[model samples]
Target: MAQVEIYDGEGDELLFTGQFDFLPRAGESIARNTDDYFHYYEVIDVWHREDSEAGRFQACLAVKIVD
Candidate 1:
Protein backbone atom coordinates (compact mmCIF):
# COMPACT_ATOMS: atom_id res chain seq x y z
CA MET A 1 0.00 0.00 0.00
CA ALA A 2 0.98 3.57 -0.53
CA GLN A 3 0.22 6.74 1.33
CA VAL A 4 -1.89 8.91 -0.91
CA GLU A 5 -3.09 12.45 -0.62
CA ILE A 6 -5.81 13.71 -2.90
CA TYR A 7 -6.17 17.41 -3.39
CA ASP A 8 -8.45 19.66 -5.38
CA GLY A 9 -7.17 20.53 -8.83
CA GLU A 10 -7.10 24.18 -7.83
CA GLY A 11 -4.62 23.18 -5.07
CA ASP A 12 -6.69 25.03 -2.51
CA GLU A 13 -8.63 22.23 -0.87
CA LEU A 14 -7.59 18.75 0.25
CA LEU A 15 -10.13 16.10 -0.51
CA PHE A 16 -8.76 12.91 1.03
CA THR A 17 -5.67 11.41 2.62
CA GLY A 18 -4.96 7.84 3.54
CA GLN A 19 -3.31 4.60 2.50
CA PHE A 20 -4.54 3.01 -0.67
CA ASP A 21 -3.72 -0.22 -2.44
CA PHE A 22 -4.03 1.37 -5.85
CA LEU A 23 -1.89 4.25 -7.01
CA PRO A 24 -3.10 6.33 -9.89
CA ARG A 25 -0.86 8.10 -12.38
CA ALA A 26 -1.21 11.54 -13.84
CA GLY A 27 -3.97 11.87 -16.47
CA GLU A 28 -5.91 9.03 -14.90
CA SER A 29 -9.17 9.30 -13.03
CA ILE A 30 -9.88 8.16 -9.49
CA ALA A 31 -13.18 6.85 -8.31
CA ARG A 32 -14.37 7.83 -4.87
CA ASN A 33 -17.00 5.25 -4.13
CA THR A 34 -18.98 5.99 -1.04
CA ASP A 35 -22.21 4.72 0.34
CA ASP A 36 -23.94 8.03 -0.10
CA TYR A 37 -22.34 9.17 -3.30
CA PHE A 38 -19.89 8.13 -5.99
CA HIS A 39 -17.59 10.69 -7.58
CA TYR A 40 -14.88 10.64 -10.22
CA TYR A 41 -11.89 12.94 -10.14
CA GLU A 42 -9.59 13.71 -13.04
CA VAL A 43 -5.98 13.48 -12.11
CA ILE A 44 -4.07 16.53 -13.23
CA ASP A 45 -0.72 16.05 -11.54
CA VAL A 46 1.10 13.61 -9.31
CA TRP A 47 4.04 14.08 -7.00
CA HIS A 48 6.05 11.45 -5.20
CA ARG A 49 8.13 11.85 -2.09
CA GLU A 50 10.49 9.63 -0.17
CA ASP A 51 11.72 10.04 3.38
CA SER A 52 13.71 7.93 5.78
CA GLU A 53 10.93 8.01 8.33
CA ALA A 54 7.86 8.43 6.14
CA GLY A 55 8.86 6.00 3.38
CA ARG A 56 7.35 6.54 -0.08
CA PHE A 57 4.19 8.46 -0.72
CA GLN A 58 2.27 10.19 -3.46
CA ALA A 59 0.28 13.40 -3.67
CA CYS A 60 -2.23 13.84 -6.43
CA LEU A 61 -3.99 16.92 -7.69
CA ALA A 62 -7.35 16.28 -9.22
CA VAL A 63 -10.53 17.98 -10.32
CA LYS A 64 -13.96 16.60 -9.64
CA ILE A 65 -16.11 15.87 -12.64
CA VAL A 66 -19.73 16.83 -12.48
CA ASP A 67 -21.94 14.21 -14.09
Candidate 2:
Protein backbone atom coordinates (compact mmCIF):
# COMPACT_ATOMS: atom_id res chain seq x y z
CA MET A 1 0.00 0.00 0.00
CA ALA A 2 1.14 3.53 -0.77
CA GLN A 3 -0.07 7.06 -0.68
CA VAL A 4 -1.21 7.75 -4.22
CA GLU A 5 -1.81 11.39 -4.87
CA ILE A 6 -4.74 12.14 -7.14
CA TYR A 7 -4.02 15.27 -9.12
CA ASP A 8 -6.16 16.73 -11.87
CA GLY A 9 -3.00 17.48 -13.89
CA GLU A 10 -4.90 19.93 -16.05
CA GLY A 11 -3.92 23.31 -14.62
CA ASP A 12 -1.41 22.10 -12.02
CA GLU A 13 -3.96 22.22 -9.25
CA LEU A 14 -5.08 19.69 -6.64
CA LEU A 15 -8.68 18.60 -6.76
CA PHE A 16 -9.60 16.34 -3.80
CA THR A 17 -6.96 14.86 -1.57
CA GLY A 18 -7.64 11.87 0.64
CA GLN A 19 -6.02 8.75 2.06
CA PHE A 20 -7.21 5.47 0.57
CA ASP A 21 -6.19 2.30 2.38
CA PHE A 22 -6.58 0.23 -0.77
CA LEU A 23 -5.86 1.05 -4.37
CA PRO A 24 -8.60 2.37 -6.60
CA ARG A 25 -11.00 -0.08 -8.22
CA ALA A 26 -9.19 -1.71 -11.17
CA GLY A 27 -5.72 -0.80 -9.96
CA GLU A 28 -2.37 -1.12 -11.75
CA SER A 29 0.03 -3.83 -12.72
CA ILE A 30 2.71 -5.04 -10.37
CA ALA A 31 5.08 -5.47 -13.29
CA ARG A 32 7.61 -2.74 -13.93
CA ASN A 33 6.70 -2.38 -17.61
CA THR A 34 3.06 -1.46 -17.02
CA ASP A 35 3.66 0.31 -13.77
CA ASP A 36 1.90 3.47 -14.85
CA TYR A 37 -1.41 1.88 -15.64
CA PHE A 38 -4.70 2.09 -13.79
CA HIS A 39 -7.66 0.00 -14.82
CA TYR A 40 -10.61 1.18 -12.71
CA TYR A 41 -11.54 3.84 -10.17
CA GLU A 42 -14.62 4.91 -8.30
CA VAL A 43 -15.68 7.17 -5.49
CA ILE A 44 -17.45 4.66 -3.27
CA ASP A 45 -19.19 7.15 -1.02
CA VAL A 46 -19.16 10.70 0.26
CA TRP A 47 -20.99 12.41 3.09
CA HIS A 48 -21.02 16.06 4.01
CA ARG A 49 -23.12 17.97 6.52
CA GLU A 50 -22.79 21.58 7.52
CA ASP A 51 -24.84 24.17 9.34
CA SER A 52 -25.57 26.04 6.11
CA GLU A 53 -26.27 24.71 2.64
CA ALA A 54 -24.49 21.38 3.05
CA GLY A 55 -24.00 18.94 0.22
CA ARG A 56 -23.36 15.24 -0.30
CA PHE A 57 -22.40 13.04 -3.24
CA GLN A 58 -22.55 9.28 -3.19
CA ALA A 59 -21.09 6.45 -5.24
CA CYS A 60 -19.57 8.44 -8.08
CA LEU A 61 -17.54 6.19 -10.37
CA ALA A 62 -15.30 6.63 -13.40
CA VAL A 63 -13.48 4.07 -15.50
CA LYS A 64 -10.06 5.27 -16.68
CA ILE A 65 -6.62 3.93 -17.53
CA VAL A 66 -3.63 5.88 -16.33
CA ASP A 67 -0.46 5.99 -18.26
Candidate 3:
Protein backbone atom coordinates (compact mmCIF):
# COMPACT_ATOMS: atom_id res chain seq x y z
CA MET A 1 0.00 0.00 0.00
CA ALA A 2 1.03 3.58 -0.56
CA GLN A 3 0.25 6.73 1.39
CA VAL A 4 -1.49 9.44 -0.56
CA GLU A 5 -2.11 13.11 0.12
CA ILE A 6 -4.89 14.75 -1.85
CA TYR A 7 -4.89 18.47 -2.43
CA ASP A 8 -6.95 21.07 -4.23
CA GLY A 9 -5.60 21.62 -7.74
CA GLU A 10 -5.88 25.38 -7.53
CA GLY A 11 -3.90 25.91 -4.36
CA ASP A 12 -2.21 24.28 -1.39
CA GLU A 13 -5.34 23.35 0.50
CA LEU A 14 -5.29 19.72 1.53
CA LEU A 15 -8.47 17.73 0.91
CA PHE A 16 -7.75 14.25 2.13
CA THR A 17 -5.02 11.89 3.25
CA GLY A 18 -5.07 8.14 3.27
CA GLN A 19 -3.58 4.94 1.95
CA PHE A 20 -4.28 3.28 -1.34
CA ASP A 21 -3.26 0.06 -3.05
CA PHE A 22 -2.03 2.06 -6.00
CA LEU A 23 -1.41 5.66 -6.97
CA PRO A 24 -3.82 7.60 -9.15
CA ARG A 25 -2.54 9.32 -12.26
CA ALA A 26 -3.24 12.58 -13.96
CA GLY A 27 -6.66 12.78 -15.68
CA GLU A 28 -8.24 10.35 -13.25
CA SER A 29 -11.21 11.32 -11.14
CA ILE A 30 -11.92 10.68 -7.46
CA ALA A 31 -15.06 11.21 -5.46
CA ARG A 32 -15.85 11.65 -1.80
CA ASN A 33 -19.02 11.93 0.20
CA THR A 34 -19.52 14.38 3.01
CA ASP A 35 -22.40 14.91 5.40
CA ASP A 36 -24.60 16.75 2.92
CA TYR A 37 -23.22 16.15 -0.54
CA PHE A 38 -20.86 14.31 -2.77
CA HIS A 39 -17.83 16.01 -4.22
CA TYR A 40 -15.71 15.07 -7.20
CA TYR A 41 -12.28 16.02 -8.37
CA GLU A 42 -10.19 15.44 -11.43
CA VAL A 43 -6.59 14.48 -10.89
CA ILE A 44 -4.28 17.06 -12.38
CA ASP A 45 -0.85 16.29 -11.07
CA VAL A 46 0.91 13.60 -9.05
CA TRP A 47 4.13 13.79 -7.09
CA HIS A 48 5.89 10.78 -5.62
CA ARG A 49 8.33 10.32 -2.84
CA GLU A 50 10.33 7.21 -1.97
CA ASP A 51 10.48 6.88 1.76
CA SER A 52 13.36 5.38 3.68
CA GLU A 53 11.03 2.78 5.12
CA ALA A 54 11.09 -0.38 3.12
CA GLY A 55 8.25 -1.05 0.72
CA ARG A 56 6.54 2.22 1.59
CA PHE A 57 6.00 5.21 -0.65
CA GLN A 58 4.16 8.55 -0.41
CA ALA A 59 2.39 10.50 -3.10
CA CYS A 60 0.69 13.85 -3.42
CA LEU A 61 -2.17 14.30 -5.83
CA ALA A 62 -3.49 17.64 -7.01
CA VAL A 63 -7.08 17.59 -8.17
CA LYS A 64 -9.35 20.10 -9.84
CA ILE A 65 -12.90 20.59 -8.70
CA VAL A 66 -15.42 18.72 -10.80
CA ASP A 67 -19.14 18.71 -10.71
Candidate 4:
Protein backbone atom coordinates (compact mmCIF):
# COMPACT_ATOMS: atom_id res chain seq x y z
CA MET A 1 0.00 0.00 0.00
CA ALA A 2 1.55 3.26 -1.09
CA GLN A 3 -0.29 6.38 -2.13
CA VAL A 4 0.93 9.93 -2.57
CA GLU A 5 -1.08 12.33 -4.65
CA ILE A 6 -0.68 16.07 -4.50
CA TYR A 7 -1.99 18.56 -6.96
CA ASP A 8 -3.45 21.89 -6.12
CA GLY A 9 -3.77 24.33 -8.95
CA GLU A 10 -6.00 26.90 -7.35
CA GLY A 11 -9.40 25.19 -7.25
CA ASP A 12 -8.25 22.56 -9.71
CA GLU A 13 -7.16 19.71 -7.59
CA LEU A 14 -5.94 17.82 -4.61
CA LEU A 15 -3.79 19.15 -1.83
CA PHE A 16 -2.24 16.25 -0.01
CA THR A 17 -2.85 12.57 0.61
CA GLY A 18 -0.38 10.15 2.05
CA GLN A 19 -0.69 6.43 2.70
CA PHE A 20 2.01 4.03 3.75
CA ASP A 21 2.85 0.36 3.94
CA PHE A 22 6.33 0.12 2.50
CA LEU A 23 8.45 -1.96 4.80
CA PRO A 24 11.92 -2.44 3.40
CA ARG A 25 14.29 -2.66 6.29
CA ALA A 26 14.87 -6.37 5.98
CA GLY A 27 13.34 -7.93 9.08
CA GLU A 28 15.03 -5.27 11.22
CA SER A 29 18.18 -3.42 10.44
CA ILE A 30 19.58 -1.96 13.64
CA ALA A 31 19.64 1.82 14.24
CA ARG A 32 16.21 1.84 15.85
CA ASN A 33 14.27 0.00 13.16
CA THR A 34 15.96 1.99 10.45
CA ASP A 35 13.16 3.98 8.86
CA ASP A 36 9.44 3.46 8.78
CA TYR A 37 8.08 6.87 7.96
CA PHE A 38 9.07 10.32 6.72
CA HIS A 39 8.43 10.13 3.04
CA TYR A 40 7.35 13.14 1.00
CA TYR A 41 6.07 13.82 -2.51
CA GLU A 42 5.41 17.12 -4.15
CA VAL A 43 4.34 18.57 -7.49
CA ILE A 44 1.79 21.14 -6.61
CA ASP A 45 2.54 24.22 -8.61
CA VAL A 46 -0.19 25.05 -11.08
CA TRP A 47 0.21 21.55 -12.56
CA HIS A 48 3.36 22.85 -14.29
CA ARG A 49 3.43 21.94 -17.92
CA GLU A 50 5.78 23.97 -20.05
CA ASP A 51 6.28 21.23 -22.64
CA SER A 52 7.67 18.98 -19.91
CA GLU A 53 10.67 18.21 -22.10
CA ALA A 54 12.52 15.65 -19.98
CA GLY A 55 11.04 17.27 -16.91
CA ARG A 56 9.13 14.04 -16.46
CA PHE A 57 5.68 14.21 -15.01
CA GLN A 58 3.43 11.55 -13.55
CA ALA A 59 0.93 11.29 -10.78
CA CYS A 60 -1.12 8.80 -8.83
CA LEU A 61 1.07 6.07 -7.29
CA ALA A 62 -1.28 4.05 -5.20
CA VAL A 63 -2.12 0.35 -5.09
CA LYS A 64 0.94 -1.76 -4.28
CA ILE A 65 0.53 -3.97 -1.29
CA VAL A 66 1.98 -7.46 -1.17
CA ASP A 67 2.49 -9.91 1.61
Candidate 5:
Protein backbone atom coordinates (compact mmCIF):
# COMPACT_ATOMS: atom_id res chain seq x y z
CA MET A 1 0.00 0.00 0.00
CA ALA A 2 0.95 3.61 -0.47
CA GLN A 3 0.00 6.84 1.22
CA VAL A 4 -1.47 9.48 -1.06
CA GLU A 5 -1.42 13.18 -0.28
CA ILE A 6 -3.30 15.42 -2.64
CA TYR A 7 -2.80 19.12 -3.16
CA ASP A 8 -4.28 21.84 -5.30
CA GLY A 9 -3.14 22.70 -8.83
CA GLU A 10 -0.54 25.10 -7.56
CA GLY A 11 0.53 22.69 -4.86
CA ASP A 12 -0.36 25.24 -2.24
CA GLU A 13 -3.20 23.80 -0.23
CA LEU A 14 -3.33 20.23 0.92
CA LEU A 15 -6.73 18.92 -0.08
CA PHE A 16 -6.88 15.29 0.97
CA THR A 17 -4.95 12.24 2.21
CA GLY A 18 -5.61 8.57 1.74
CA GLN A 19 -4.06 5.19 1.03
CA PHE A 20 -4.16 2.83 -1.90
CA ASP A 21 -2.78 -0.59 -2.66
CA PHE A 22 -1.14 0.52 -5.88
CA LEU A 23 0.86 3.59 -6.69
CA PRO A 24 -0.27 5.70 -9.59
CA ARG A 25 2.18 6.31 -12.40
CA ALA A 26 2.72 9.61 -14.09
CA GLY A 27 -0.14 10.68 -16.38
CA GLU A 28 -2.55 8.39 -14.64
CA SER A 29 -5.76 9.83 -13.26
CA ILE A 30 -7.30 9.34 -9.87
CA ALA A 31 -10.45 10.68 -8.27
CA ARG A 32 -10.15 13.11 -5.39
CA ASN A 33 -12.31 15.51 -3.48
CA THR A 34 -12.08 19.26 -3.21
CA ASP A 35 -14.45 21.21 -0.98
CA ASP A 36 -17.43 18.94 -1.69
CA TYR A 37 -16.86 18.18 -5.35
CA PHE A 38 -14.92 15.23 -6.72
CA HIS A 39 -12.37 15.72 -9.43
CA TYR A 40 -9.75 13.75 -11.29
CA TYR A 41 -6.05 14.38 -10.84
CA GLU A 42 -3.31 13.35 -13.21
CA VAL A 43 -0.40 11.74 -11.48
CA ILE A 44 2.74 13.79 -11.81
CA ASP A 45 5.17 12.03 -9.54
CA VAL A 46 5.36 9.30 -6.98
CA TRP A 47 8.01 9.29 -4.28
CA HIS A 48 8.71 6.61 -1.75
CA ARG A 49 10.99 7.38 1.17
CA GLU A 50 11.21 5.01 4.07
CA ASP A 51 13.07 5.03 7.36
CA SER A 52 13.45 1.57 8.77
CA GLU A 53 15.05 2.66 12.02
CA ALA A 54 12.35 5.21 12.68
CA GLY A 55 9.68 2.79 11.44
CA ARG A 56 8.31 5.29 9.03
CA PHE A 57 7.21 4.73 5.47
CA GLN A 58 6.42 7.69 3.28
CA ALA A 59 4.71 7.69 -0.08
CA CYS A 60 4.38 11.16 -1.49
CA LEU A 61 2.62 11.89 -4.73
CA ALA A 62 2.34 14.97 -6.91
CA VAL A 63 -0.65 15.41 -9.18
CA LYS A 64 -2.23 18.01 -11.39
CA ILE A 65 -5.88 18.91 -11.79
CA VAL A 66 -7.47 17.00 -14.67
CA ASP A 67 -11.12 17.98 -14.39
Candidate 6:
Protein backbone atom coordinates (compact mmCIF):
# COMPACT_ATOMS: atom_id res chain seq x y z
CA MET A 1 0.00 0.00 0.00
CA ALA A 2 1.01 3.61 -0.48
CA GLN A 3 -0.08 7.13 0.17
CA VAL A 4 -1.27 9.37 -2.62
CA GLU A 5 -1.65 13.09 -2.57
CA ILE A 6 -3.12 15.16 -5.37
CA TYR A 7 -2.25 18.78 -5.72
CA ASP A 8 -2.48 21.66 -8.11
CA GLY A 9 0.10 22.06 -10.82
CA GLU A 10 1.95 24.64 -8.79
CA GLY A 11 1.75 22.38 -5.72
CA ASP A 12 0.28 25.26 -3.79
CA GLU A 13 -3.05 23.64 -3.07
CA LEU A 14 -3.73 20.16 -1.81
CA LEU A 15 -6.66 18.56 -3.58
CA PHE A 16 -6.85 15.16 -1.99
CA THR A 17 -4.96 12.56 -0.01
CA GLY A 18 -5.50 8.89 0.67
CA GLN A 19 -3.98 5.48 0.97
CA PHE A 20 -4.23 2.93 -1.83
CA ASP A 21 -3.26 -0.63 -2.39
CA PHE A 22 -2.40 0.26 -5.96
CA LEU A 23 -1.48 3.70 -7.15
CA PRO A 24 -2.59 5.07 -10.43
CA ARG A 25 0.07 5.28 -13.09
CA ALA A 26 0.88 8.27 -15.23
CA GLY A 27 -1.87 9.27 -17.67
CA GLU A 28 -4.59 7.72 -15.57
CA SER A 29 -7.61 9.83 -14.74
CA ILE A 30 -9.26 9.82 -11.35
CA ALA A 31 -12.16 11.72 -9.87
CA ARG A 32 -11.13 13.83 -6.91
CA ASN A 33 -12.63 16.24 -4.42
CA THR A 34 -15.96 14.65 -4.96
CA ASP A 35 -17.41 16.22 -1.88
CA ASP A 36 -16.55 19.63 -3.21
CA TYR A 37 -15.93 20.21 -6.92
CA PHE A 38 -15.89 16.65 -8.19
CA HIS A 39 -13.03 17.40 -10.51
CA TYR A 40 -10.98 14.97 -12.52
CA TYR A 41 -7.23 14.73 -12.33
CA GLU A 42 -4.65 13.02 -14.46
CA VAL A 43 -1.67 11.38 -12.94
CA ILE A 44 1.42 13.19 -14.17
CA ASP A 45 4.16 11.49 -12.28
CA VAL A 46 4.80 8.77 -9.72
CA TRP A 47 7.72 8.34 -7.41
CA HIS A 48 8.75 6.35 -4.41
CA ARG A 49 11.03 6.81 -1.44
CA GLU A 50 12.39 4.05 0.73
CA ASP A 51 11.74 4.22 4.44
CA SER A 52 14.48 1.98 5.78
CA GLU A 53 13.51 2.41 9.39
CA ALA A 54 9.87 1.62 8.66
CA GLY A 55 10.82 -1.09 6.19
CA ARG A 56 8.43 0.24 3.66
CA PHE A 57 8.20 2.49 0.64
CA GLN A 58 6.27 5.69 0.28
CA ALA A 59 4.77 6.61 -3.07
CA CYS A 60 4.14 10.12 -4.19
CA LEU A 61 1.86 10.97 -7.05
CA ALA A 62 1.75 14.24 -8.89
CA VAL A 63 -1.50 15.01 -10.62
CA LYS A 64 -3.03 17.83 -12.57
CA ILE A 65 -6.61 18.94 -12.89
CA VAL A 66 -8.17 17.72 -16.12
CA ASP A 67 -11.34 19.71 -15.90
Show the lowest summed lDDT stretch of 10 residues, model 2: 56-65
Clashing residue pairs in candidate 2 (N, C-alpha, C atoms within 3 angstroms): none
User: Which tens-of-lDDT digit does each residue in 1-67 have in candidate 3?
Assistant: 8779998888879989978788889999888878888888899999976778777667899999898
Going through the candidates in the order shown, the clash numbers are 0, 0, 0, 0, 0, 0
For this target, which candidate reaches the highest TM-score against the unseen true structure? 3
- Expressed as tens digits, the lDDT of each residue in 1-67 for candidate 6 is 6677666656646666788878889998887566577788788877776889999877777788778
Cα TM-score of candidate 1: 0.65
Model 2 ranges with Cα > 4 A deviation: 1-3, 25-67
Q: Candidate 6 regions off by >4 Å?
A: 12-14
Instruction: List runs of model 3 lying over 4 Å from the truth.
Output: 49-57
Per-residue lDDT of candidate 4, residues 1-67 (tens digit): 7443434334545545545464222222112121684433332232223337867543332222121
Q: What is the C-alpha RMSD of each candidate to the true structure, in Å?
A: 2.8, 11.1, 2.6, 12.4, 2.9, 2.7
**Higher lDDT: candidate 1 or 2?**
1
Tell me the deviation in Å of residue 12 in model 6.
Answer: 6.8
TM-score of 6: 0.67
Worst 10 residues of 6 by lDDT: 6-15
- Per lDDT, the best of the predicted structures is 3
- Model 2 over residues 1-67: C-alpha lDDT tens digits? 3344443333433344445565554333212123575433333323222334445322212223233
Ranking by lDDT: 3, 6, 5, 1, 4, 2
Q: Against the true structure, what is each candidate's TM-score?
A: 0.65, 0.26, 0.76, 0.20, 0.67, 0.67
> If both were scored by TM-score, which would come out higher, candidate 1 or candidate 3?
3
- lDDT (10s digit) by residue, model 1, range 21-55: 77777777777777878887887877765555868
Expressed as tens digits, the lDDT of each residue in 1-67 for candidate 5 is 6666765647546667888898778888898676899888887777666879989877667778878
| True lDDT of residue 13, candidate 4 | 53
For candidate 6, give the lDDT.
0.76
